[model samples]
Each structure stands twice: as C-alpha cells, then as structure tokens.
Target: MPSEIAPAGLRERKKEETRRLLLEGAAHLFKERGFEGTTVADIAAYANVSVRTFFRYFESKEALLLPDGVEIFAYVEHALSERPADEAPLDAVCNALLAAAKPFSASTLTALSHPLEDIENVITARLVQAFSDFEERLTVLVQRRLPPDTPDADLKAAVIACAALSAVRAVLRTRRARRASGISDTGPAPLLRAFGILHEIGSPERP
Candidate 1:
C-alpha cells in the first residue's frame, strides 16, 4: 500500500510544482507587461504549460498573479499561540504578524508590483474576504489576553485586530508604491518604520 501511495504523492507534488511555476510566471508577466497586457495564454506559454493545464492550477490569470497569503496566516496562528503570555495585546498582534511575515518578507517585497489598480476588482476584495474569518479568530484570542477589568474588551479586541490588519496593508502598499516607481530595494527600513508606527498606534499619548 505504501508503494502504491508513493506514486500518488509524487503526482501531487508534480502538480504543486507546476502550479507554483505558473504563479511565478504570471507574476513576472504581470510586472513586465501590466495586467491587461498579459493573458492566460501568455502565462501558460511562459510556464511551458498548456492552457488546459493552467486552468487545472488556476481558474483565471488574475488568480495566478495575486498571492493567496495562506502561508502567512498559518504562520500567524502558530506565532500567536507561542507568543509570551506577558506580551501586550497590541504588541502580540503586531509582532505575530511581522514574525509571520519574516519568511516571506523578501519575496513579498520583491513581488510588490502594481498593487494600486482596480483592474481586478475581486483581487483585494477576495483577499479581504478570506482574512475576515482569521481576523475574528485572532480578535477572540487577543481579547482573552487583556485584563478582565478592561472596559469595552470586545471593542478593544476588534480595534487591535483591525489596526494590525491595516498596518500590514499599509506596509505592503508602501512597498508596492516604491516598487512601482522603480525603487531598487526596500531593505529593513520599511520593517523598522512599520514596527515603530504599529508599536505606537494604540498606545497612550506621550507626555
């Protein structure tokens, strides 16, 4: 049975590899020629796969061009659980997101191309919809971390969760704008700057 299952596993791996290839190819094409200039056939040809094979991987070219961010969310869930109990609620949310972003940070910055357009209305909409459920789950966890005496704990949790999401979007948007303008690299400066902003956002006003 193990021997029989090995072939199936190998086939699945091959499919994933092809899918990744298509995604990479699509990203390059979208950056090079813009979204409207690129097509399903262009991505298929670039990835050395047939149009039918491309359909097997992604229903549309736009889907291939945009990242799903599933891995980042998975990392966030794990990071949140492992964060020190004494960590502040805002810090935990912010740090968990940045920590989760670490592995993909380089690729994410490198691929920061043309994120401003509404050419694909469903692009941001789709990603936002997917994140809503995870945000709710994180909000519950964050609320539990706060003291019981904290007033309006639900509102506090929702605020922190929303702020964290906004901070992430802001950082990526900055990088996209930088990339779109032919910036060579974003470096760790954006990360540091973003950290300071996120770290300070919900804090009490300084004297």
Candidate 2:
C-alpha cells in the first residue's frame, strides 16, 4: 500500500470504481483474445455490466484499451497542483503519480500483465494524440523547483520528466510481469525507490 493515497470525493470514488471494473474486464478479454478480437459487448458481459454502462465509462471499444488516457493524466495534473508548497517539485510530481497508481487492484494488475506489445502499440499512439501536453506539463512542474540560475533548466526539466515517466511505466510493467509469475509483492516500496532515484537525478547541489 502507498504511504499516502490522495483523498477523493465520494462521487468521484464511485465513478473511478466503475471505470476500474471496465478496465479490468477489458484487459482480461484483451489478454485472452488480443485487442483486435475483443468487442465492447464482450467486455461489458465479462464485467457483468450492461453495454450502456460500458458506454458511460468509455467512448469506444478502442478507448477501453487506454483507461489511463488523457482524463487520468489531467487528474494527475490536478494532483500535482495540490502538492504542499514545501515539497520538492520533482517529489511532488512523483508522489502525485504514485497516488494515482496506488488505487490499482489485483485484478487490474492481472489485466495489465497481458503482453504489452499490442496494447502498448495502441495506447502509445492514442497517448501521443490525446495527452500531447503531458510532457510539457511535467517539464513546467520540474523546472519550477530548479535553481533560478541553473543552466538549461528547461531542457533539464524535460529530461527529468521524461525519465521519471519512463521509469514509472517500467515499474508498472515490471510489477505486472511479476504478478503473472506468481510473485505478489504489490507494495509501494518499488514506487518510492523509483521516484527517489528520479529525485536524486533531477536535484542538484546548492554549493
């Protein structure tokens, strides 16, 4: 469990729960049959929900493949805004990301353990189109914490954000792969370590 999970309003929590079910069900189907072979109706049935319910959660069958799409990252942006003023910006962003990831359940991990090649191909394309500004947002957050005189702050910020995001993606991918192999170490220690390393890389000495 994460040391700190962000608080969500009741209605938001309920909606997230629904979206979670849809994602888990869709992932299970995608793993068994592959993305090209799954249908909206199939996912809904697997999740024990009506097609209307599925539509309420996702715009299309393809959309089901990317439950962590723009809207989720946008929520993460909101989380980023809420971090305490005293916290390092890199730490804030990493904590915000960890908070977002902390809610994933066992079943969700099972869904994600599916071979990422096909799923990654689809979701990566969609992410590039949908959350194009995500990288920029992260850069701004990171640069805000750098010393005012730091050379190439903008470029450094971009690198930090990209590295952190890429590392996070690796963490989840590796965790899921572990779950598939019957390893149940689903704690936040690995998350903390990844961000801790990212922070070390992003932060510089004050001299």
Q: Top lDDT: which candidate number?
A: 1
Give each model's whole-structure lDDT. Answer: 0.73, 0.70
Over 59-130, each residue of candidate 1 has an lDDT whose tens digit, in order, gives 776565446455667788789888899998888887787677667755653333333354455455656665
Relative to the unseen true structure, what is the C-alpha lDDT of residue 23 in candidate 1, on a scale of 0 to 100?
A: 78
- Candidate 2 backbone collisions, by pair: none
Tens-place lDDT per residue, model 2, 77-175, is 777778887786667778887776666543443233332445537755665555357778878987887789989999988876777677766677777
lDDT of 2: 0.70
State the RMSD for candidate 1. Answer: 4.7
Cα lDDT for residue 148, model 1? Answer: 92
* Candidate 1: regions farther than 4 A off: 1-17, 25-66, 105-118, 185-189, 204-207
Candidate 1 lDDT score at position 68: 49
Runs in model 2 deviating more than 4 A are: 1-25, 45-50, 69-72, 106-120, 127-133, 144-150, 199-207
